[model samples]
Target chain A: MTRLSSAQRHLVRFTLNGKPVQGEAEPRLLLTDFLRQTIGATGTHVGCEHGVCGACTITVDGELARACLTLAVQIDGCELRTVEGLAPAPDRLGVLQAAFRRNHALQCGFCTAGILMSLDHYLRAHPKPSEAEIRDLLSGHLCRCTGYTPIVQAALEAAAELAELSRSDHRDV
Target chain B: MKPAAFDYVRAETLGEAIEVLAQHGGDARIIAGGQSLMAMLNMRLARPKVLIDIMRLRELDRIDSTSGSVKIGAGVRQAALLAWPELATSLPLLSKALPWTGHAQTRSRGTVCGSLAHADPSAELPLALVALGGELHLRSAGKQRKVAAREFFAGMMATARADDELIEAVSFPSGNARCAFREVARRHGDFAIVACAAVATKDGVRFAVGGVADVPTARDWPRLEGSALDDALNGFAHELDARDDVHATARYRRDLVRLIGRDLVREVLQ
Candidate 1:
């Protein structure tokens, strides 16, 4: 189903969020450029651009990847998510975003979105994580401002809050 | 940080990847999970005119055990291998060393053969592979060859693999041994300044050192039993030629080579 188009350009088609999107790009086009420039999702930041920093992280087919390194044409049959597409709807904060707000997880807010995306996916899979586990999971993410304590606290608080909400849902059911 | 413009080819099968490598020759670079290659490409340390992505070669992504050997495909990711309970129970040295290679996110994309190809002397997998006495499988157009782990690693960031060949899988025998890996690094997740993997078998013990050699070294064979181990442990400090690094001094690395080596020997033999 997948084959090389030609030397210079390759046409790729895949769904971004709930919408079908397609693009023709140079073979050297990074996925970050395709997302921010071609697809206009500015939520994905190109931090470090060299993969040393995790600010360029995004979920590709439910796995975290540095979008700056992944070529645009590589995700032809993949599901991609940038922080801009994170909310239930546009311009709205999701559970992780709201958790950051209430728990003061962000300061300068540059790395917050990528952290949220990574943590959001992690929390969805793991509704509750211990403090050490939180610290361990956040090793890849670096936040110069908040000292990471607040972010760690935010994740813990969010996990507890979500557990309480889920417990109430079970009782109501 | 844009990579140089090049042709992109997705190899659906390992054969396709081999053919692409043969056709493209020196112009090609094979990417398994793009963990190390991507970083290198961005830094301009490595630039190839053609990239052959072998990530979708599902036929090559596997880990299995036979009667006396365990086979691990080259395309197996580091995180996947770290999560393998079987490997942990069977090969704890590898499990202990995986976290020392890179951060969790990077390890999620890094692959075994990818690590071998990158051949960072500070890397943990190579030392572990050396102590484990593994074999490397190399394949090219119409030819396949096997190289012992001791032979595959030639120098810094180098391997015995031909430009037109790709690693297939690594098979290692279980020698009824107890293995352990230890290291000192700048931080918990950073690359090791000095690391060692030690395996103790019925006949003898094997000690492999990384981060100290241009290429990692595995020695201390012929079973330094009892007084011999004590002598080595006592004077092991002199055997190393460690160079200064950002995280450690040459003298400190030399001492650590002995100290950690002795402790690991104790953990293995006792």
Candidate 2:
């Protein structure tokens, strides 16, 4: 068993959005703070630290999780993905982001990063997700803006686009 | 809110975790999935001097389905149980209620044993466990014991488990009993305002209610129909002592008990 002192900062190393990253964190340091403060990746927002708000949603080892609920030391050596990893390039928005833009899914955009991360992970597994499924998946998040109708539309559209892209890639292969 | 400073230990084995718990007792807390515990830590509801990480204990991460019961280990996440191939066939009630436990994101990280450990009055897992008449396997450094689901849950956010004991696993009996689960929440994946689970027995159905009382409560009844069922549900609802919270009124909760309780009992019995 590996033990770290609560009072001292420990070296935490993990793969961040496919890149190896290391930071120092005390035992009480939440993954949300570690990502935004230590690693300097502010894409993963921290709204409600108590896990009720889905603003801090990210993926640990490719599984969707709330960053606020996760301790930084716990994710050691795990592959972590946040909203910053969504886009393929600096200038290009990913398919899901583009869909959100087209559908006007986000208004204030506070909840967008977490929503995008969730949709990105969910759509990959459920490429043929129905409207109800999208809404169900989205229940984790709370958005005061856009009334969720546009967000649902964007998720469905993104799923279709992702499915179509995969089919075409198969054809090309 | 941020958690108070505490030492962290990533336990490589169950034995190591037990040792740590033995040393610190109430001063140490077990972290498995850390869904509920982390939330408490953030809110400073629970402040342990040391946090033991048992997620890495691969031996504890198992879903062993025997012919009689489905035993879920401490490391079994809510998502893993939901994804289990035999879950629907073995524990239909869990399959129905697991989706309502939490959102997909939280479910992916929340452990089944952890939920039972938290023992939230309105939580689905504890209700399902009680309704199914499951057994919780608890172990300490020196001794191990099995506690019945009905006896395990003492009260709201409370269990009979000792601080030195870690819930090793929980076993739910596998049967062909028709089961039904219904919940009324502010939103999907939210904590249930009133959750009910009914399981058909030989002579009658076992009805369980959550969110209406301090702990998930169950009542066994002979098969009844129409007004008889309604009267029984009403009596049970009153017995729960539903409280008025920000999400709902006590009367509204009792009403749900009568309405949703009737629906679930009938669905399972039929």
Output the number of the DockQ-best candidate.
Answer: 2
Model 2 per-residue lDDT tens digits across residues A96-170: 899999999999899999999999888878879989998998999999989999999998888887878887784
Residue-level lDDT tens digits of model 1 in A1-173? 24454465777787786678888788778888988888787888878877666787888888778787788988987988778766766657666677889878887888876787778767777887988877776777778888889898888887777778787784210
Please list the C-alpha lDDT of all candidates, in the order they appear: 0.79, 0.92
Docking class of 1: medium
| Interface RMSD, every prediction, one decimal place | 2.4, 0.5
Model 2's DockQ?
Answer: 0.93
DockQ of every model listed? 0.52, 0.93
CA-RMSD of model 1: 2.7
TM-score of each: 0.92, 0.98
